[model samples]
Target: MNHALKTYQTWLNDSAVDEETKNELRGIADQPNEIEERFYKDLEFGTGGLRGVIGAGTNRMNRYSVARTTQGLADYLKKDGQDPAPSVVIAYDSRNQSPEFALEAALVCAGNGIKAYVFESLRPTPELSFFVRRLQASAGVVITASHNPPEYNGYKVYDGTGCQLVPELAEKVTARIREISSFGQVHKLEQTEAEQKKLLVWLGSNRDQEYIRAVASVSPRSEQMKSLAPQLKIIYTPLHGSGNRPVRDALDALGFTQVSVVSEQEHPDPGFSTVASPNPEEKDAFAMAIRMAEKEGADLIIGTDPDCDRMGAVVRGPDGKFEVLTGNQSGALMIHYLLSSLKETGALPDNGAVVKTIVTSEMGAAIADRYGVQTLNTLTGFKYIGELMTRFERDGSFRFLFGYEESYGYLAGNYARDKDAVLASALICEAAAYYKGQGKSLYDVLQELYRDYGYFKEALISRTFKGKDGVDKIHSIMEDWRSRPPHDVDGTRVVRALDYLEGIEGLRRENVMKFVLEDGSWFCLRPSGTEPKIKIYLAVRKTSNKEADQALKQISEAILTRID
Candidate 1:
């Protein structure tokens, strides 16, 4: 037998292998190609946790991998021991086998003699974070693949504070996961058996109530809601994910009387039957919501991803056509509305600050500066922003007012450590109401922002490379760019460069490289950590929107010529 097949067979025959697990292994062994794919290597556990296509291999997301990850987490929690019986909260999104995966994690936690609180139904990822703190659990796990396609699913680990596992803690968990040599060694207990031992518990509306109360407290215009709430018409779509219940409750609680949910995409469909992808950031995903909005003559439309950690909006433009706003544009509008409302009502704090990822538009910084609030830039991930929030709350530094990323993620009020699309949905509706009071549309607000911010525009280009050959191609692209960087793109001369992998700011050793041009046009090239893709981000600032777009297109072609 080949070494890889032998290793897998050994796992199948091991005494620790459960009947169901053995069945899965036998199925994989029946197909040679399946064995190659599943046992090629272990599923990577990085800062984000385990994410991959769901299948029967060791490389796929199954009960064994979930159990192994939970065991590692249990080991870490025990090592950082505060209590003999630490507790954890588990939540799942609307995905195929999500409930099964969530239960698998719960069972593993129970087998370790740790208390586990499993949600009664699919819930938003942010709510899992909120539940962690609300229950004061030692840790939390959310089963989701966020905006990925239907074939994919993932596991995201959250600490006691409800934030995704940070770098240091992730390393610890990775070490433990690596130590578990085979899937057969991982332990688990049946759900009923664990419940009888008092280790497994079911949680429900109590945590939901706490989250809703916290979200309600962050409203800047509760009194205005009473008067203007009846006049506004808003359309919302959960995109067949988990935000259906919480988003409606938040809108109703804020006194919005005429809110409608997109019926075609309302239910939890793992296939995301209504759209090609469940991501709110894409215009295609909003097609159903847009049709509903036009039918109902809605003023604004909002959509959340399957996991509800990211949100997007479409508003009526001056031409009477609905236009979907980009992530940066929506984030900037939210910041403007929130800060302006707070300042108008004497609620804006002197210590207020905002956080955004480095690649996010500088338009937000321009708005923050005008308000005399500090804006801090962090790494690409939202967890960095969450870490900054932790620091601010720990020390007497600037207060964390809002934090967001370019990938349609936003957070407000610090109720949840991760992005809360439900909060963004509510805030977008309130912002629409605020604009309606002034006889303007949210599109008008975006235009005004562009006028002040010099028509700042950004675009993202992602090239997917699949399998082993794809990895080598991605590395070659990065190396080629590093060796002979672009001195000029289109008609613009390169003014500066920033590399993140080498930890250099202007010119660093990192694998990421950014080229700044004389015309204020820029492009960044970086490899994705979770997937096999190379992403290029282009931004251009011009006096006119057409000029900025032309510049972006020119630079994009140049980048493609160099990389592709």
Candidate 2:
């Protein structure tokens, strides 16, 4: 018998397995392909943690997988020796089984004699990171798939510093998880017993209030917000996720009175029925918000993802139509606003620095350079940006003014180590108000930045690869690109090639390749860490929008042709 088949059979026969789960297994037993897909391998607990389709299989995210992963994390924590009473904070977003999975993780921790602080209800991922440091917990776990589809759910871990576990620490946890063979063998305590033992603690509005107060500190011009917020019309949608209360509360606290929520997406819906996907990056996610904004004559529309860590926005342009701002454009707007605001208020630090991923546009860096603030680059993950923040705290060298990615992730204050949409939402609105006070829209300010700096445009191409074959193809593509990088792209000679896998330019080893063209444009290709996708990032700087658009299209076409 095949190993997977045998494993499936064993699962069917195990008394410890719930009948419902076994019934699911029985339903798929006749389908060998389904059986193979489910039992071929254990669901991996990757660097940060597990993210998979919620289902009843070794390769899926279920209660058993959640418990097992948490048990392994518990064991690792014990070995790592955090404190006498090691503790972990847990938060869940609005997704099917998010609450159940969170409780299961907490039970596993309690079973290991570790204290677990769990939110009474769903909260944003950034709050989980913030409270991890605020409560002095050993670690934190957020149950969410972020902006992924409804069928998907995830478990992400954060260190005491409130950043996702770096490579070294993640390796330790992954190794510990591998040593555990059976998900069925993972021990967990009953919820009642855990509560009675005082190992389980519930976090509530107190934490939420503190988190909102911290978000208020990100406001650029509070006085201006007090005046302009009432007049500035804004529309926001959480997309049936966790951002409803926090995002709204943060804005209201900052005196933004004209804010309106999309009623259809105001409450948590596990299915996210209103949108095709809950990702804010997608235009569909903003449909309801845009319509609401149009009806209300709002100046801006903002949407947050499932976990509420990444934020996306749309602004009414000069053309009298709403246009969505790419993450790079919004990032540049925030950077320019932050530095310029600080300078105007005489609060700009001498040792201030802005951090961004290598794939992010250079426009923000250019804006920072003009302000005499230093700009630093990191690998593509917010974890890397958070890691740099930790270093900054320890060395007291550079004050982290802002950190962002080409994706919709942004961070302004150090209150939370991760990308914070709640804070970003407030800062973005304040920036809008400041610009509004000047008789302009956020879009206008962005245009001014483009004119002041060069016209910088960026685009991304993500190709999905499913199953084992897809994984191999992604690896092959990355390897081929790394080994033989393009010498010229779209008639522009390649100036330099940086293969991150070779650990060049002081960056840690990663499977990413970058080609810089003589025209000062660059493109990078790398495999996504959490998803089964290969992403290509392209950016170009030109004197005009037409030239930039042309250069970007040509370079992107050339790269796609090579891939095909």
Compute each candidate's TM-score over C-alphas: 0.95, 0.98
User: On residues 1-564, what C-alpha lDDT tens digit does candidate 1 reach at each position?
Assistant: 775687688777777667887787786556886776667677775435678889766678877788888998888888765756699999999999999999999998988889999999999998888989888898999999888889988999988888888777788887887888766666778888999997889987766877887887788888898887778898899999999999999888999889898888899999998899998889999888788888889999999999999999999988888999999999999999999989999999999999997788888888988998999987777777888898898896988899998889999897889999989988888888978888888999889988887899999999999766687899999888888877777767899877777776432133677788898777888787677788898888899989888888888998898777
lDDT values, one for every candidate: 0.85, 0.89
Give the lDDT of residue 314 in candidate 1.
95
Q: Which stretches of candidate 2 lie over 4 Å from their true place?
A: 1-3, 45-48
Assess candidate 1 and give its lDDT: 0.85
Window of ten residues with lowest summed lDDT in model 1: 502-511
Residue 444 CA displacement from its true place in model 2, Å: 0.8
Off by over 4 Å in 1: 1-6, 18-33, 81-84, 505-510
